[model samples]
Target: MEWTLWFSYILLSFVVITLVHSLLLPNLSKIRRIEGVPLVSVLVPMRNEVRNVKGMVDSVKKQTYKHIEVFFLDDESTDGTSSALELAVRGDARFKVLQGKPKPEKWIGKVFACHQLSEAAKGDYLLFLDADVRIQPEAVERALGLMQQKNISLLSGFSRFILPTWLNKLLVPLQHFFVLFHLPILLANWTKWPPATAAHGGFMFFERSAYQAIGGHAVVKENIVEDVAISKRMKAEGYRMWIANITSVASCRMYETNAEVWQGFTKNIFNGIGRSIPLAVGIILFYGVVYVGSGILALAALLVEERVLLLPYLLIILQAGIVYLNTREPLALAFLLPVASVAFILLLVSAMRKSVKGQQVEWKGRYYG
Candidate 1:
């Protein structure tokens, strides 16, 4: 029992350290625009994104960068996505809406759409963005400036969450927590190791030449988690890839309701953890122990008059507090840390079970087997 408490303390300490490191990491800055304007192609792969098209395109149209051409590929969206896009563009010469081709054999939908967009892009840099993302006017200029100043081949940054629903407020922050706490930003940037590389699909910026060299989305055509796969490939090929916090410049509302959140996360969470059952199980168990188990143990200790167990419980709360602060979640949410942790554990287990049973993962009205 004493050994178990000590182990829990060690794990909680590690989490707190990681959270502190995440907070210390710097945000991407807005540098002055470069001399000659370089043409940038902004790619959006839309499938049933009618609700997001207008706002997304409006944001793109408002970019401060002068030499950007926006491409919106309609991936056979059955909704009013095409009409919304057309209305958004309003026949702007800089914005073109293309009809996406049918998915090729064994190719995923989004990757196929992206591949077509890349083939049609005529620019020095290619920026792939999700339709749900909203960017500030200076987003493009700032990102380009950072790329040029750092000599980056591929640059990806995290977006802030616009949590509207109750479940969203509780769960959306986990995205930041997963990346910031588990992956050390400093080590990822300084190391050439593939495992250390991290990228977000919401905002992926790449130099045209380097993108082509890495084969763009073609290399990750079938991967559900294409962003991480591309980041790994880039690092493996000796390309300089940088990942930073761009929350100040961009935000995304990934899911609106509880069902959407569940489906969206279930589709990729297993693969996100390396698609290894052992690793999945280990992660779930570790989180359960540190976050959920500690709370239960503390209550039991209180009932049985065991004072030693309270130490681990306090450590868990401290760890949760750090995570909340780093992820910008409300401090009040820390009190619900145990509940949230249990919810996350259940989600992880559900994802793992589905993957193990060969159940098809559904997203955007398509199934990934």
Candidate 2:
């Protein structure tokens, strides 16, 4: 019992400390302002982004940088998105809406659209952004400056979450925990080991040279979680990559409702964890036992007045609280970790089932599966 308690405490301590370090510690890369403001092409691949396209287009128009051209790709969206983009791009010489080429049977929707956009892009730097994300006026300038200063090839980071409901707060914010706890950013740029690769496709900037060298989006045309795969490939191929907390520069509402959240997470959860059944099962069980078992043990300790066992359980709760607080997820959701664990397993099972049946994942209105 003592050995078990000590091991659990050690694991909890390690996890909490790592997360805190990643969030609190800053990476001090020398950021330089874009020298002479290099021409940048902002490419947005859209499918049924009617609710988001106009605003994203307008946001680019408001950029502080002058030599910017925006290319919007309508990936066969049937939700009146093309009409919205047409109206938005009308008479705007800097913005052009391109009809997406037919998706090759082998290519994923985003990668195919992105590949087409890259072929048409005329900028020295290519910024791939999702239609759902809104960028501030200075974002382009800041990214260019950071890229120049850090001497890095890719600038990938997350944006602020614009959650409007409790459900969004619960599920959407859990992604912070997902990224932070699993892939700590503090150790991502260390020189000793391969950097922990991560990128939010909602906002990513890459040099045209690097993009072309890495084979562009065409390389990972079939990956469901395309961004992470791309980042990993880039890192493995020796392109410098860095991620910052870009919460101040941009914002995104990943999903509007609970159903949207479920669909969104279900599509990528398995892929994010590497599609390993044994690993996924182990994670689900690990969290279930520690988080769920701790709660039950705490309750039993309360009823039986077992102070010795209660101390460790209390420490576990403290660890969970710190994790929740740092992740910005609702603390109440901590108690439902077991439920979330089960849901994640079910999502992975669904994803694997589809993959085995020669089907892939789907998002928005398109069936990439």
Candidate 3:
């Protein structure tokens, strides 16, 4: 019983430290306007993203950064994505929809598409955005302002999830929780430490010279979690990387249904952590005790009339609240943290089971191990 109380205190301490670190996490500079900015190449790689093409093109047309060329690399998308893009960007010279070449052996589909975009792009800076992402008009201006000020070579962050379903709300925001709680801000942003890296392909901004120096996406062609892999490569080449609070400027509706959410996470979670069984076990135990156990203990505390058992549960709620506040997610989601944590644990278990089975994970109509 006393140990439970101590563990709650430890969780409280972690929450405090995470809150302090969250404050130091970079916010996109409020640079509303800029003159004579360098040519920026905005690249979007699509795979059966027909529903998103018009929206993506519309967002690009509405951007404040007019000196930009946008490329829609169609990765053999069969859902009429290429035709949709062409129709959306009709008479717009700045936007070009390129037919992506066949993905070679040992290369991931998205990475191959990005490599083609890199080869074709001619700009001082490169911005890779997923098709489902919607950025504010001033997003590029603010992002470039921050990168220029910090002299960062690569900048990326998970976009805020546009939650349209209960499952989406519960799972998507956990990405923010992991980023704030697991990643150390100073080492990831200030130093060129390869292991201390985190990135999101949803909104990756790169300086042209630094991107070329690291061989672009070719360096991490086979990596399923290409975002983090590329970021690590950037750091390995002595280039500084920055993870920003991009929720203010960007939002993504990544998965449509609960099944997709489960599958999407299962596909990347194991690979994201380097496919280490020990790490998976450790994560399971930690979540089991620290998160899921909290709710269980709280229930037991009510029956046994032991009030202290609720401490960890309440602390976790506080932790989720703080994380949501910093990440600009709906604060009301805080009340559902325990439920979400449980769902996340189950998702992790599902992910681990697949990884152990050596099964090929299917995503966007392609299979990957």
Candidate 4:
């Protein structure tokens, strides 16, 4: 086949993959409620999250699943996070505020906090909620329903991201794109292969027995990307893992500012790919040719009035449309995918440079390699 045909084949493959992948991710809205009334411990690890304290408290407070005990561990925050957490859940006896122990050597801050929360938890199901997340009242119930329906031990869902800025929309939604486009959803959910796992730290719900069986956060104690690390470990131990589509019932605004976005992504993006330089380069090149190239080709096609030359760009837009359909963004935003592609490529490159130099990445005022 000629180069154009080869390029067309690859792009078409991605479109098909995206279609199949999206279908494989379980939709929270579509699942029927489960019959089990297992107790769930809503474990939240907080560090300088004063702004999200009230929102987090209110969401879990209103959960229709009445058998939940919420645990909030303050990870030694200087910004009065402990006080705020105390005040937010003051009237609610179901919520417990625990002061986090000093993080021992070789443990990530959040991981240590989560470990403490699990030690104090007395529930059958452990739902690790991030302080920034706000879920619907039925979110917990539906999550358990999916777990029972799928017969999975660990259920992790990527929430609908609230993009407050143009840059936020451009970059954050790439998470959905990468997940739906690259990961074989069937393998990740059904297979016990460690390498096939993907997870979001913001919302991780695990069966307490399975979590303990897999060694929990201690298994991934030193891992920089603990969410993915923990999921992989669960798979390694022959446990089932499911990545769900909880966009219908939950939303999270991860980074409030562009700097936070840059830093947070920089800290995780390279490590998220196992710190492989080749994978980073291949991803940058792939987007450069498939997505960014589509824009350039479209412009040239318009100049020459060639209808055939527009096919690749149109296909790219169609692929974007399918992804945005699940993300709840406007269908028209698909046209801006090339721009998002560029932004992602640049961010990846910046992360790569920092990783290559052995620079420590910072999060919540703590530095890590």
Top candidate by TM-score: 3
296: Cα error in model 4, Å: 1.5
Give the distance in Å from residue 165's predicted Cα in candidate 3 to where it truly belongs: 2.3
TM-scores of all models? 0.92, 0.85, 0.97, 0.96
RMSD of 1: 2.3
lDDT, candidate 2, 1-369, per-residue tens? 686578566756756774675565233233445676588999999988899977898889898877989999999998999999999889889999999888888888888999999999999899999888988888888888877876778778777677776556655655655555666565565431344777888887998898889898989999888887888777877888777666666778788887787678777777777777787778767666765566566677788877555554555545555556653445766655544555555666777677557775567666654
Q: Give Cα-based local distance difference scores for all models.
A: 0.84, 0.74, 0.89, 0.88
Candidate 2, lDDT over the whole model = 0.74
lDDT of 3 by residue, 249-367 (tens): 89899988988888888888888889888988898788877888888888989999999998888898888888898888998887777788889878877877887887877888999
TM-score (C-alpha) between model 1 and the true structure = 0.92
Ranking of models by TM-score: 3, 4, 1, 2
lDDT of 4: 0.88
Model 1 Cα displacement at 152 (Å)? Answer: 1.0
Q: Write the per-residue lDDT of candidate 4 for residues 1-369, one digit (tens) a residue.
A: 266567777788889989989888888886476776789999999999999999999999999889999999999999999999999888888999999998899999999999999999999999998988999999999999888877789999788888877788788888888889988898898899888888999999999999999898988888889999999888888889989888898889988998888888999999888899999999899899899998887788889887666778888888888988986766776888889889899998988888889888888999976
Question: Candidate 2's error at 176, in angstroms?
Answer: 1.6
Among residues 3 or more apart in sequence or in different chains, the pairs in candidate 1 whose N, CA or C atoms overlap within 3 Å are: none
